[model samples]
Target: MSKRTTPVVAGEKAGSKRTKAEEPGIRILGPEEFAVLVADLLPTT
Candidate 1:
């Protein structure tokens, strides 16, 4: 599948410290939370 991206204008920023799923006011996750993310991404493990 082709990954489509928005066209950033000149002088605009693209990267973020957090990923697309993370929202504001949320503390950085601990190991258990990160593990859940990994499990969710797996293919029917």
Candidate 2:
């Protein structure tokens, strides 16, 4: 049987302080804005 995994990474401790999307530093982009940011990552002919 496989062992269960955790959401915390090695450098990060569980239940540590985290930034929320509502915070001023965090910017929530719309679909159009997100698409523009990742457009270069998509494959092209």
Candidate 3:
């Protein structure tokens, strides 16, 4: 069986001054990463 790895999502901490979306410190997920996140949320039969 193959091993599955979980993707990491990085972002600003709570109560940070750079809470605005226009800030340059934001982290963006690619299409593959986004799909993996969605798959993890789905119910398994």
Candidate 4:
């Protein structure tokens, strides 16, 4: 029988810190803004 080894997953390290450039941008949209954005994608039928 062969020995089985566990594989390490990416981004599973403890206490990992991301640099400014590596961080993702977050945006907070108002109710009106969100509705407008959704309306643009939806078809008018």
Highest lDDT against the true fold, candidate:
3
Decoy 2 TM-score against native? 0.40
Model 2, 1-45: lDDT tens per residue? 112322212222312222333233334455566676678788887
Pairs in clash, predicted candidate 4: none
**Which 10 successive residues of model 2 have the least lDDT summed?**
1-10
Query: What tens-digit string does per-residue lDDT give for candidate 4 at 1-45?
Result: 112322212232322332221234323344567677779999999
lDDT of 1 at 4: 40
Q: Which candidate wins on TM-score?
A: 3
For model 4, the superposed segments whose C-alpha errors exceed 4 Å read 1-25
Please give the lDDT score for candidate 4: 0.40
Would you list the clashing residue pairs of candidate 1? Answer: none
- Once fitted onto the true fold, the runs of candidate 3 whose alpha carbons sit more than 4 angstroms away are 1-23
Worst 10 residues of 3 by lDDT: 1-10
- The per-model lDDT (C-alpha) reads 0.42, 0.40, 0.49, 0.40
Q: How do all models score by TM-score? A: 0.37, 0.40, 0.44, 0.42
| lDDT tens digits by residue: candidate 3, 1-45 | 112323334344533432332254454455677788889999999
- For each predicted model, how many residue pairs clash, with residues at least 3 apart or on different chains? 0, 0, 0, 0
